[model samples]
Target: MQRKAPARGFEQAEFQARTQKAQALMAQQGLEGLLLMTEPDVRYFSGFHTLFWQSPTRPWFLFIPASGKPVAVIPEIGAALMRQTWIEDIRSWSAPAPQDDGISLLHELLAPLARRGARLGILKGHETSLRMPLGDWERLVRALPGLQLTDATGLIQGLRMVKSAAEIEKLAHICTIGSATFDQVPKQISQGMPLEEVFRAFRREALAQGADDTPYLVGGAGPGGYADVISPPSRRPLQAGDILMLDTGATWDGYFCDFDRNFAIETADDAARRAYDVLWRATEAGLAAAQPGNSCQDLFQAMQGVIAELDDQSGDIGRLGHGLGMQLTEQPSHADFDCTRLQEGMVLTLEPSLGYGDGLIMVHEENIVIRADGAELLTRRAPPELPVI
Candidate 1:
């Protein structure tokens, strides 16, 4: 017989606390149970972690009742991993079955709640995408009639928005590692280095500095500024007077730190320098305004007040910044329309962007945790002036 694997990830108590909190929310919302199909939600409540989610072939499901441990309906391939979590009522089926990928099993598991006229919750709102196939979801809906499906996006968002002490520690560790790597760019980067090589070196530096993974890395380099923020790196070579920005969503123990730093290649023009200064000031304004009892709109306005020619468009980058924890981007986006109140223990990023010369823009970002009195910075502060590499 093979030796059993030890339980990993968060402690049993942490998962229990999470389940209890989610249960209370479910009860308040009149939800009989929550059916989680996304990776973050399932892992958040069950402490199950796996990189196999990269493949979109098989869909995993977790059933969270109003007041008890969650039931994991996953594939047999993940049985060992699921067993290592705090969950005991594990139900496995041979996945990638093509015809029936755990749909029948999920229907059987949720049948009891449906019989009680209890509404089941699923995430189907803003910033959320159904993780399972449409045919399977439709089949499950038909399998259990009168089982009203409600949106649990708000409930899950509320629980994940605030960070526990342990989660905060993991995020801080990753942020520090990313900051250290950013500090080395001035020496490692040159005017003629290709953007692709720079990206590779940044990832290497992040791993060397103890980052578990560098999953999100996007940036651009241009003479005055970059046009798009989310574009992949091209083979374009850096030139004098170019402004380069690298934003990373590096992880430590599955927690992420989302921020970026800007650098000038050899030299920066007056327009670029001024734009950098404005962006830096905007970030400071956001940091000052991020505290308990404040609204996300308030933080957005505060940052927008300082920047010159601030554009609030829903383009490549939706909002100035958004809630960060457990995933690269969470909820309560810092946009003018969002009124979500900032509460203590919430981790967020203060990202402010402004247009520079014609069609070029510069952006600055920082990460912080909301506190009772004020905001506590997690990543090391960027220099007041953009460094010339």
Candidate 2:
């Protein structure tokens, strides 16, 4: 059944609370302001949502001062839309202006902080970028001599890691749509169909089932198992003994639901069935370990312990799963090296994969949110045993 979509975009209060949270963290870190350039960061604080970001022709910027609402310094084309958002101070410039591209406006907005040599924050850590021309970045740095630009990856990402009640509602809605789309797979695919057509069928089904978009869809098929998880679908057709998997990142509003379902094309080998059971049980272990007090390291160990019963090497896929939200995969990955603690309202994915029988592999994934009580599943659970079409 089709679920009702959540209300589009957040209210002004939601953006205000987000800004206030970042401002409080900025205070603790001694940051006078945050300079945001990425699409996600700008939208998080300003609610300035647009597909205009698709073009790199114009760069956008959002500045969160020590007080008040966010300021948008962007191209003139976006001004009217920016005005519609909660932001009051919208500065615009005509663009492809490699000559001046909002640098003058940014300097004007931040010059006061520059004079005092006050510390400013921007993301410069893993999974983040400047999202602007390198030459322009140098010009802005040279223009503002005393402003100390520090990395705000931790401060910014920390706030985003946890979900608000309003945000959780959007995520849950999309997960339901994605789950409904997956449920149609058995009826939509067949043995003679090419893998590319299968991929197309999924995108169509996801959109029809009320997903805003199915931006991410990937997986593989082989006699017993697939080669890799991230490969694009080839023209190869499915065979009776093939095992197929489809993982998707489907969106509703601006939130995403990420998970996958595995199906046996006609029949399965004993080795394939056993691998599925091990991965299913491993995901169960991960769910049990996803509590408020546990760290990502603890979650990794819980899942890894079960996977070890099969592939002691764990198939070398690196991290088991990661935090999920605005982007398909966010920070606080489930891995031994990461010790980020689980907190209530944090959404995550439990993914387990193992290698068996002459270089073949199988992967399983489920989405859940960490809760005070424990982990709450977001996606419908896959069958305990692999289903044969």
Candidate 3:
């Protein structure tokens, strides 16, 4: 199936509604303001997209008030780009200022709430972190001692868990691009090809297929099955009986589509073929179980039941799958510990893996969105049987 790329960026109304919803949640929690420092959070509210986040020399900030639009307290260099967003109040400073480093600006913006003993929320729970320097963070904390700093991991992750119609469009577009790239793997490489070159070829194909970037591409090739799923590509050459996997998190615009495919180099062994069959059937179970009413645990159990037939222990990787969006992985993890219920408009990856044959593991993944009725695949489904190159 072919899909034309959706329009880049988002409409002003998209950000406006997002901000309104965040504000409503903030008001319910008695949060005076929600402070964000990470790239995804800042980009979620204000469409301030840039690769400048790669540099650690400066820090950026966004403050979401309980009533109106969010404020962008950022470096002087980003002022022009931030201005293009729907944001109204864009505060700027000469960043990397050893003396102030935007702390003074943050203090002034948050000081009023300090006087009234108002609560402020920063993401402080699991899967969250402060992207700024620790010394600078301590300085800001010391400056605003009166402000009640609370953990807002739940509040923010909750708001971002479900994707909007516009967001889903971008997601679907990227997934299409990734799928097209994956389909070209057999033509790109075969036995005697170096694994590292295979990785390079994948990046080139993804970019040629319309992906903005393939920042996350890792897999391993080995006899029968791979040692593990997360190993970086080695310089070793592919050979007969080797199982090759390439898991990619290709991006278009700022959205990401994470999935992987497995191909047998020349031919596959009996053990590897059986493992692939189990994983494929497991994914089929996952596709059927992924519904609006199913919980993440329910989804996990459905796939786990199929995987357990061959291997009781799923791979070392903690969760089967996770929420997908701006970043590679998001909240509402598919695992026993996570009971987050599935809802319409929530996008996720159903990854099922199994261990077989003297510590070798095989993992299969696919991207999908939860519709009112069931799961709709974003990435093209892998073949039932592993392909031989």
Candidate 4:
């Protein structure tokens, strides 16, 4: 299916801004060149997409250096798409035939840098699996003997954590789609409707409203309704007394909007309402901790405090929110493992859900920016306790 061109927005300008932003990182890391093989990083630097990622048969990489123009090593079939991107230098290779070696083509792309000591940085290198086989790595090593290789994950993540103005606008537009689709969910949902059908309805509605991609959507409708944490939407039927929780996100122009709300099929039960109230309170605490100059851990701690107060002993995910921008999930995660401070340009989601015998309730909300005063709420309306239907 032909994807509708992204609406007139800030994506074009944002792409340029991101490239310039990465230039400084490359210089700072002392990297002669950086190779981007993963989806998020590839999409971040180059506005391109491909499903060829499923196989290691032909690996694609984007090579960027501090001082010069970037180059793309892609399959010949995708050469046209690569040319369509802003990056000017791209090399195409024919499929690996018995006569032609794929590694030689990759080395040919990187051969010029052999004299520069071939100090290359690979992002998400340790995490590559079948798509980037060991043979490819060995070929790169053998192709450039004595090359100094390093992990570029941190350098890449740092650049991505901060959102440019164009990025913020794109994300806000995605949020608009999510809010509009959510508003329609209550109207479309009904008792006895299968949960799977309801979920599909939301997906169709989101695409109709101009969603370029669906990044995250996991929810369910069971006897007592769905769980707190996002589980995949299932075939469970929506009983008259059951509650429905649909937490989903739509990615547009490389930006994402993650928002979820709980819907009561008929009447709001006392147990469900009470659980929702606690989750809402936790979400408020998370928002309060999102001020500029605050640590990401602080925001997570605030949410944890709420979960600790609950008498029930359900295991909490221990993180209040995560940064949302070009990728559905980005850096500065609100967890003990991360210590990055909040900045004015950062956008984050505050989703704190509690699961107990009282029935699961999710209070998912999101905010963008750490303003001079405080944080800005990106989501339209707060999640409802019950469906208005």
Candidate 5:
């Protein structure tokens, strides 16, 4: 007989905690149930990440009622994978060909609660099920015309904002893999190496170090080139005076770690060296603002203050940092305009960029988790100044 495959990294306690939090939110919103269909949210609540998402022919539906255990109404192809986890109750239908594949399954699972006058909470913005016709969802709503449907994305966003202990460990492991990969890039990026060669070398190193894939990888090299935010590496060979920006990250298991450092090829230029120091200070200022009870706006302001003090041209076109979770870039990005509060257990990236002159810009980014004391650095490596060649 063949042996069963081992379970993925899963913690029952974490699931229960999340469920309890959701239940509280449901009570506050007066929602009878929440209908989660987004891939990340589904995997988060159900602890199942199946490859069946590639088939747009069918959508996976997970119904988390205000009370009791959650039930997943998924395609038959994904049912087996769901069984591998602690989620025992699952209902599935065949496919597009079946008379009533996903539509029928969803109605059957929700009909009883709808009859009980249950209000359905949906993340309409991210719901892929509504893509085609939404005819099935409409029919189900009509079946129980009294049932109410409202947006419940806030409940999910709240739970995900606070990282659990297990999640932090996974994120830390991801950072370790990323840092290890970056540590080796110096040897490969010499004065004469092509930009593509540097890019390929980093990709290979990251994968070999256990990264499943990279979500972000864009960098460039030029004596005074930094015009575009993210462009493909060019065929031009890296020269001694080139200032290169390598901002990249890779996913390990499922968590993602992002870190970017500026490097000066072979010979260090005065402008590049000064830009690096300013960005380094700005990054540190941003990290310093990440503490319990602080506002995200304050964090960006801290970096903004440093950048403005250094160069009048410094401005934040993007968020100072964003919350990182299962799907890499999530929420809580520290925008100079946002008013969100900083809380403990939140993992964010402290990256502040400064653009000056034509094709001259500097950026330094790192990851950290908010703690009671202060910011806890996840990516422990020091920022690079010049290429090690």
Candidate 6:
């Protein structure tokens, strides 16, 4: 089925500014063009958005040269949509073809760059993966001989970390919606309700509160606390004295707000209450330390110092938090090993977790944008005390 493209997602000037920034980075890196195959990269530069990407049978490609407009090489089904974007060069072919698929077209687009001895950058690194199939990538590599393929992961990450004013506004709006939905938990949720039902109710509330979509929602419930941060909701009823945590990556206008809140079912235990306080204070420390010129590791340490005695459960949940923008999780992980500098305009999350008794854990998260003087909260600050339902 052919999909009609809506008008450009943002003003033309927004995309134009992004293109100029990317071109400047490409010039600094001595690269001729960027071969963007991921959804976020393609949409970021071209204002192209489609849920059609859910299928893996066909791959879409976007090429941003060192200068000038970007070119789109996508399936014919997406031609109408690509035309709606700022891109002018739209190359399409019948995709999912048993033999060719869109490989020939992609190779043709890159052949000229190869002939000119140009270095082409592709996103390949931590948290980044090739959207195209391995067989297709191998074939393209063989077809484009002498084309210098380099890791442009850093280049793309550097550009995406800083959110434009419009992007920040969208992010802040979604976060506000999420916070409102969470506010209804006390009234909407109750003891004995199944975890799965709680998940459904929370998602419905988010939608009712103006969320366009809820892409990610994972949570857990246990007597003292949850053992894992990313587990799917279970069918077990929410029992009294259990610590129930709900983490969501709710979206509005393609922008996502990633955060979570904890609720005590009926009553709370001393261990759970103390753990919540520790996590809350840790997040406060992170917020106080988040400013321009500070590194991500520095932020991690500040939070870690606040709860050093408590077992740091951040290792179990990956980084404390990560850069958030177009995707639910982006670059610049908030971990001791990550050295990415905290720059103004970067949107991030300060998540702090601690282990309580009986192998239980509690995680608290908040979203913020790095500002010139300090960090500005995106999501309304969660209540300092754990709210008991």
- Using lDDT as the measure, what is the rank order of every candidate, best first? 3, 2, 6, 1, 5, 4
Clashing pairs in 1: none
| Candidate 6 lDDT, 283-340, residue by residue in tens | 9999999989999999999988877767655435656889999999999999989999
Compared with the true structure, what per-residue lDDT tens digits does model 4 show for residues 102-184?
Answer: 56666776677775676677766322332455666776678687577878878887777777766777777788888878878
Highest-scoring model, lDDT = 3
Query: Which 10-residue window in model 4 sums to the lowest lDDT?
Result: 1-10
Clash totals for all candidate models = 0, 0, 0, 1, 0, 0
**lDDT, residue 220, model 5:** 75
TM per prediction: 0.96, 0.98, 0.98, 0.88, 0.90, 0.96
Off by over 4 Å in 6: 1-8, 312-315
Question: Candidate 5's residue-wise lDDT over 239-286, tens digit each?
Answer: 877777777778865678987766777777666677777778888787
lDDT of 3 by residue, 175-197 (tens): 99999999999999989999999
The collision pairs in model 4 are 264-387
In candidate 4, residue 279 scores what lDDT? 75
Scored by CA lDDT, what does every candidate get? 0.87, 0.91, 0.92, 0.71, 0.76, 0.89
C-alpha-based local distance difference test score of model 4: 0.71
User: Where is model 3 more than 4 Å wrong at Cα?
Assistant: 1-3, 312-314
True lDDT of residue 353, candidate 3:
88
Model 5: clashing residue pairs? none
Q: Tell me how far the alpha carbon of residue 288 in candidate 6 is from the true structure, in angstroms, after superposition.
A: 0.4
Candidate 2 stretches with Cα past 4 Å from truth are 312-314
Instruction: Report the error of model 1 at residue 306, Å.
Output: 0.9
Q: How much does each candidate deviate from the true structure in C-alpha RMSD?
A: 4.1, 1.0, 1.2, 3.5, 4.2, 3.8
Which has the better lDDT: candidate 3, or candidate 6? 3
Better of 2 and 6 by lDDT: 2
- Local distance difference test, candidate 2: 0.91
